[model samples]
Target: MTTLTVFYIGLFYIAAIIFFGGLAYRIYEYSRTPAPLNIPTTPAPTTAGGVVVRMAREVVLFESLFKSNKWIWVFGWLFHVGMAVVLLRHFRYFQEPVWFWVEFIQPYGKYASFAMVAGLAGLWARRFMVDRVRYISTPSDHLMLALLLGIALSGMMMTFVAHTDIVALKAFALGLLTFDWHPLPADPVLLAHLTLVAVLMIIFPVSKLLHAPGIFFSPSRNQVDNPRDRRHIAPWAQALERDNA
Candidate 1:
């Protein structure tokens, strides 16, 4: 393998390790953390089954966000749903025989990039145009958006402007999965897109992007508002009560 190939292989391996390992650790911490209050958001579900339905609406419909800000919610939902489809389409690269659904979605996923980019542009514009959002925006927030925009634009360029060796690209991805290192096409646009992807994966665990997983652990979202029926006590509080008794 050439030096470039070796570097990419190593880079991908490291990114995978960091991404998976970091997510695992973060999830473990979230699971272990105590929520001592029954503080589900208002109009909350009182039952476990009701909570599931509520969460489903929140995840799929962005119901709360829609009620709060229709424009932001529209853009945010479009971006998230587009990203999900795009990710599903990418399964072909890693699979020996891509799933039927993934293959079927290729056309939609191919076009979904436009929605993703448009939504991203809208969100980025908010940071600059909305004084409240702009006031709280940090350097890292803009940097993250730039990284995503770069990845999306470079990918679109490869798809629409410059032709990339996608066959070779799939081979390279599968090779990594199988402990073999295939020479990656050093197409500048492709390289730029992939480098940003790797960086995103590496930083995801520590970044605000973790809100994706952390949402599941949120007390207000996940908790059942049944304090009247059941007393809530944290683990430490339980121990203290035992000692006092």
Candidate 2:
């Protein structure tokens, strides 16, 4: 294997392991950490079915955030929805026979970069311009935006500015999946994009990006507002009672 191939293959494997392992650990911890109180946000869903619907609306429409701030909601929605399409489009790279649906959306996904960047720019600007947001914003928050902006811009440059050998890139990606080594296109933008992507994956579970999964564990969102219907007891509190008995 060539040095570049070895380096990337090893780096990807390590990043994959960390990404998945960290997520599993985080998820397990969230599951075990009980919400001792029935603390669902008020004017909230009452039934389990209603909770699911609320969550769906929250995920797809950013309903709550939209009610809070329209501009932030607009930018956040554009970036996230564009990212979903782009990620789906990228599934073609790993598969030997790309799915027909993935192939069909390729063009749309390629251009979604514009929306993604536009949204990120709006969000990044809010950090500088909005006093409350700026006060709470950490260096890591700005750095995360920089990393995402870098990845998206570099990718756009690859697509429109200086196109690389995508065929070779796809082959390299597939080879990594099958343990059959292939040479990567030594394109600087592509390399930079991939490097940023790897860092993003490795840091994702540990970063605020974990809000992706952490949202599922949040008491305000996940808990049903039904204190009258059933008693609420934290697992640790129950355990203490059993020990005393």
Local accuracy of candidate 2 as per-residue lDDT tens digits, 210-229: 98998888889988888999
Candidate 2: RMSD over Cα atoms? 1.3
> Candidate 1, residues 42-79: lDDT per residue as tens digits?
77888999888888888888988999998899889888
Return the lDDT, model 2, position 193.
92
Candidate 1 global CA lDDT score: 0.90
| Model 2 accuracy (lDDT, Cα) | 0.91
TM-score computed on alpha carbons, candidate 1: 0.97
Q: Which candidate number has the best lDDT?
A: 2
RMSD of each: 1.0, 1.3
Give the TM-scores of the predictions, in the order they appear: 0.97, 0.96
Query: What is the lDDT of every predicted structure here?
Result: 0.90, 0.91
